[model samples]
Target chain A: MASWAPTVLASDTLIDANAVDYLIVGLYFAVVLGIGLMARRQVSDSVDFFLSGRSLPAWVTGLAFIAANLGAVEIMGMSASGAEFGLPTVHYFWVGAIPAMLFLGVVMMPFYYGSKVRSVPEFMYRRFGTGAHLVNSISFAVAQLLIAGINLYLLGTIIQALLGWPLLVALLVAAVVVLSYITLGGLSAAIYNEVLQFFVIVAALLPLTLIGLDRVGGWGGLTDKITEAAGDNPETAPAAQQLNSWPGNALSGFDSDLLSVVGIVFGLGFVLSFGYWTTNFVEVQRAMATDSISSARKTPIIGAFPKMFVPFITILPGMIAAVLVSEIADTKAGEQVAGGTGGTVTYNDSLLYLMRDLLPNGLLGVAIAGLLAAFMAGMAANISAFNTVFSYDLWQRYAVKDRDDDYYLKIGRLATVGATVIAVGTAYLATNFSNIMDYLQTLFGFFNAPLFATFILGMFWKRMTATAGWVGLVSGTLSAVAVAFLSEDAFGSLSLGVIPVGGQGAAFLAAGAAFVVDIVLSVVVSLVTRPKPVEELKGLVYSETPREDLVDADEASYPWYRRTLPLAGVALAMVVVLNVLF
Target chain B: MPTAPARATQRRHRAGALDIRNIIGGLLAAYGVILTLMGLLGDPETDKTGGVNANLWAGLAMLVVGLVFVAWAVLRPTYVPDGGAEDPSAD
Candidate 1:
C-alpha cells in the first residue's frame, strides 16, 4: 500500500455473504423496482417523464438531492481519502461543499426555476444562443455518460467482489436495475428511489461507525492510535497534521502550508465546488424537480444538514480501518499487503475491509444492499439528467424540430436505454485510470470550471455577448486540457510534468486556469461584440429581473424554521461549529 | 352538493395519491422486522462488533423511524393542488 503505488481493484474475493444477506439485498431490489412501477403511473407527459412534472415536496427533493451525490465517489473515494489523509478530508465537506450549496439555493435556483427550462443547456440557449447551448449540451451529455459508466463499473466490481460472478454479468446486472427504473418512470422514479436509498445508506453506515468507535475507544483513543502509527513510521505525515483539519498539505499535495490552505479555499471550495454544484445538471435537476421555487431554494440547504455530518460515518470508518485492521495499517505504513480486489491492497479497499472486520451476516446484507442503492442512485441521476438533455436540448432543438410531446417522451425513454448501453462501453474506458477520483476531478475541471466562469460572468455582467459565451467556454476548456497535459501524472505517464502538481492539485490548477482564461477572454470579446438587448435579458441577467420574482411571497407567513433564509442561516451556523470542533 | 366529511375525504385522496412516505415507510419497517428477528433468534455476533447487539439496536431504531414516517404521512398528507403546474411566478 505504498502511497505512489497504482490504485486498482485486483485481489481475491473479499466478502463471504450468506443466504440472509442475499434475502435482504433481494428485498431492496424489489422495493426499488416497485417504486419505479408506482412512479410510472404518475408519468402522463414529457414533463412528467423528464422533470417529475415539477411536483415533489421540498423534503423529498432535498434528500434526493444529496442522495444523487452520495455515489461511489462519495462512499468509496471519500473513505479511501479518510484512510489516507485522516481529519483533513473533512475540508472537502465543510469548506468545499456547504458554502457553495447555500449559494446555489439562495442565489442560483431562482433563476433556474423561474426561467422554466427543462435542462441546464436550455437555459444556456435562452441566455447565450445556439453556440454555447450546443457546446454545453454535448459536453454535459458526454460527461454524464462517462460518469454513469464509472458508477456502473464500481457497482459491478462490488458485485463481483461479493458473489464471485463474472465481470460482464455483474456489469449487466448493475446497468439493468438502473435502466429499468429510469426508463419506466423517468425522473420521478429516480428521485423517489434516491430518497429511499438515502435512508438505506444511513442505516447501513451509522452502525459501522458506532461499532468502530466503540472498538477503538472513541475519538480520543483513535487519535492516540494515529499518533502511535505516525511515530512508528517516519515516512508518513506527522500525527499533528493527521489529527488537525487546517492547512491540509497531506490532502492537497502542496509543499507549503499556505499554498495548501489557499488551494483548498479557492480551488476546491470556490472553483470546483461551485462549478460542479451550480452548473452541473445532475445536481441541479434534483432541485429543479420541486413543487415551487421556495422548495427548490430550500433543497440544498436541507441537504447541507446531512452533508456536513457525513464525514463522521465515511471518514471515521476509514480512520478506524487504518488503525483497527492489520492489513490496512500495514498498507498505510507503506508495506505491500496481500489481499483485496487486486493482488495488492490499496486505500480504496478501506471501507470493505472495515465492513468485513466488523459486520455480521444480517447487518452485512444491509450494508451490501446500501452500497448497491448508492451506486444505483448515482447512475439513475446521470441517466435521468442525460435523457432530459438529449431529448429536449439535442434532439428537439437540432435533430428534429416541432415534434409532438408524446414523440419526445418516447425519445426520452429511448435515450435512457441508449445512454445506459453506451455507459457500459464507457465503463471499460474508466478502467484505464489507476485512481477514479483523479479521473473524475480532471473531467470536472475540464467541463465545469469554464462553464461556471461563463455562467457567473454572463449572469452578473449583462455586457457579456453570445460570441463571448461559446468562445470563452471553448478556450477555457482547451486551457484546462492543456494544463492537464502539462501537469505531473494528471494523464498518467502522458503528462509532461512541467507544472509539478499531481493528482487533485493538478485538477485545482486546471480549474483555476480555466476560470481565469475564460473570464479574460469573455470580457475582451464582450467589449468588442454587441450584447443582447436589455429587454431580452429579463430573467437571464441579474439586474434586469425583479427582486420579487426571485423569492416566494408566501415565505414570510410561514414559521421561521420553514423559511429559506432562516434554514440556510441555521445550516451555515451548524457547519461553522462543525469546522471549529473538528 | 357533498357533505363536509365527504368533501374532506375527497381532498385527502386528491393530494399525494401516491405518497412517497408509504413506500419509504413500508420498506424500512420490513427491513427492521427482519433484522429484529435475526437478532432475537440468530447469533448476536458479539465477537465481531465489540460485544454489542448491533442488529437488534439498529433494527429497533429503524423501526421507530419508519413508524414516524408513516405516522407523519397519515397525519399530514402532502397537499399537491389539482393543477400540476402551479408556477405562480411564471408570466
Candidate 2:
C-alpha cells in the first residue's frame, strides 16, 4: 500500500462512503438552513431581503461570491479540463478568469457603480427606460435559469456517480436543499452558507491533492511515470508545445498560437470581464449588495488572491492524473481493467474514475462533501441571482410597491421554489450534450456582453441617452446571438475564420461589436435623442454624502496607486507576466 | 455652502478613443478584420478558399464598423454630468 503520509488518506477510504458521510453532509445542510432561519428575521423589507439592507461587509460578499460562483460545474469542469489537457488547462480559470476580474474590479466596477442603480436590470431601466427594462429583465432572468440549469445537472451527475443514486431523485433533492435556505433567507442565507462552504470544500480538497501525490509517488514519481510511458513510444505522445505557456488544446492549432494567447488576454481581460462583472446578475449581485461604497469596492478585490490559488489546489491533481492513466487501468497485483487514453478514460469521466479507484473511503466521503459544497454553493448562488431577477425585476413590477415585506419575501420564497424546479429540470435535460456545462458558461457570455456596454456608455459618456442605450442593447444582443448560431460550425475547433469567431473569440467579438455599436448608435441617435436631466445624473454619480459621515468619506479616499490608471498599469503588467510565466 | 475645492483631482475623464479597453476590443475586431482583409489582400496565411473570401468580406464590413466607432468617440459631443459640470471634485 502507498504510505499515507505528507498528507491524509487511508486504505479503507476507497470503499468508505457510508452513513457517516451522509451524516456529515446532512449536518452541513442543517447548519445552512439554521442560518437562513436566523438571518430571515433581519430581512423585513424587499430592500432588506434583496439587498441585505445594504449592510453586509465586503468580506462576506467577497467570500460568498467566490464560493457560490465556484460551484460544482466550475469544480467539475476545470478538473475535467485539467485531466484532459494536463497542467496547462488552468489558464481558463487562473490566467483567463482571474485577470478578467482584476480588469473588471478597476475598469468595470467604477463605471457600473457610477450610476446608482441597485439591480443590473435596473441599470437597463435608467439607460433604456422601463420598456426596455422589461425586455432585459426577462432575458436576464432566463440567462440566470440557463446558468442554474448547468449547476443543477453537474451536481446531480456528481452525486449519482459517487453514490450510484438515480439522477432524477438526486436533482430533486439537491434543488430542495439549496432552495430551502435561499427561500428562507435570500442573499444573506446564500452568502452565509457560501463563506462556510468555501472552508468545507477547500478543507477537503487540498489535503486530498497532497496525500494523492505521495501515493502516486510525489512530483518526481509522477514525472517519471509519465515520461516512462510517453518515452516508451516517443513518437506517439504529444510533445509539450510552448512549454505549456499558452494553454491550448493539443488537438487544435488555434490553441497554440500567440494570437490565441492574445485572445485569452483580451477576450477574458476586457470583453468577458466587463460582460460578466457588469451584466451577470449572479456574480454582480455580490458587489451590489455592499452596504457602503467601501464595502462595494472591497469584496471583489479581496477575491483576487484566493481566486489565484484555486487552480493549484483543484486542477493540478487532474494534471497528475493524466500521467497516471495507464497505471490506473492496471494494479500492482493485477492486469488491465478498462479503457484509458492520456491517463483519462474520458475528459468528463476521468476524475470520478480516479476517485472511485484511487481514494480511500473516508477521504472519499470528505471529497464527496467538497463536491456537495461546490454543488450547493454554486446552485444556491445561481438560484439567488435567478430569484432576485425574477422577484425584483419581473414580480415587483407587477406587484404593488406598498406590499408588506413578508408578502414579498414570501413571493421570493415561491420564486426560489420555482427556480429550483427549473434547475432540477435543467439537470435532467443536461444529458443532451457530452460536455454541456463548459459550453453553457461561454454561451451565457453572448447575452451578458451587451449589458456591459450599456453600463459603460451610461456612466462615462454623459451624452449617451436612455433611448440610445435601448437601441444599442437590442441591436448588439440580437446581432451577437445571430452571429453565435451562424458562426459556430465555421469556427469548429479553432476557427477564427468567420466574422463572429469561436467561443472565446466570439465573447470578445460580440462585446466589442456591441460596445462600438453602443457608442455609435447611442451618440448618433442621442443627437436626435433627448438628454438625461442634470438632476438625475447628480443622484447617479455621488450618493448625497451625509454630513455625519464626512470623516468616513475622507478616510476612505483610496491611495494614489489604487486609482484607476495606475492600478490598471499594474493589472496590465501582471497580465503580461502571467502570459509569459504560465 | 459647499464650494469647489482647490486640491488636485484625478483625471477620471478619458480623451483618447482607445485605451486599455479598446486595445482589447480592437484586437478582437482586428483579428476578425485581419482574417477578412487577408482574404482580400490575397495573403496565403488567412486564405481559406471560400473561408478567406468570406473573412475578406467580413473584414471590410468590420472595418466600416470600426471606423464608425473611431469617428463616433472622437467626434461625439461630451457632456459634463451635474456634479461634473459644477463640482471641482469632478474637475
Number of the predicted model whose lDDT against the real structure is largest:
1
CAPRI category for model 2: incorrect
Error of 2 at B32 (Å): 54
Note the Cα lDDT for every prediction shown: 0.86, 0.57
Segments in model 1 whose C-alpha atoms lie over 4 Å from true places: A1-12, B1-17, B79-91
**Per-residue lDDT of candidate 2, residues A388-505 (tens digit):** 7777677777555656556767777788888888877776555655454336644555566667666666666667677877777787777665554555432244334455355445
lDDT of 1 by residue, A259-364 (tens): 9989889888999889998999999999988988899999999999999988888988989999987778998899998666545677878888888889988899
Provide the lowest-lDDT 10-residue window in model 1 chain A. Answer: A1-10
Worst lDDT window (10 residues) for model 1 chain B? B1-10
Fnat of each prediction?
0.56, 0.00
| Per-model TM against the reference | 0.95, 0.73
Roughly what TM-score does model 2 have, to 2 decimal places? 0.73
Q: Score the docking of each candidate (DockQ).
A: 0.33, 0.01
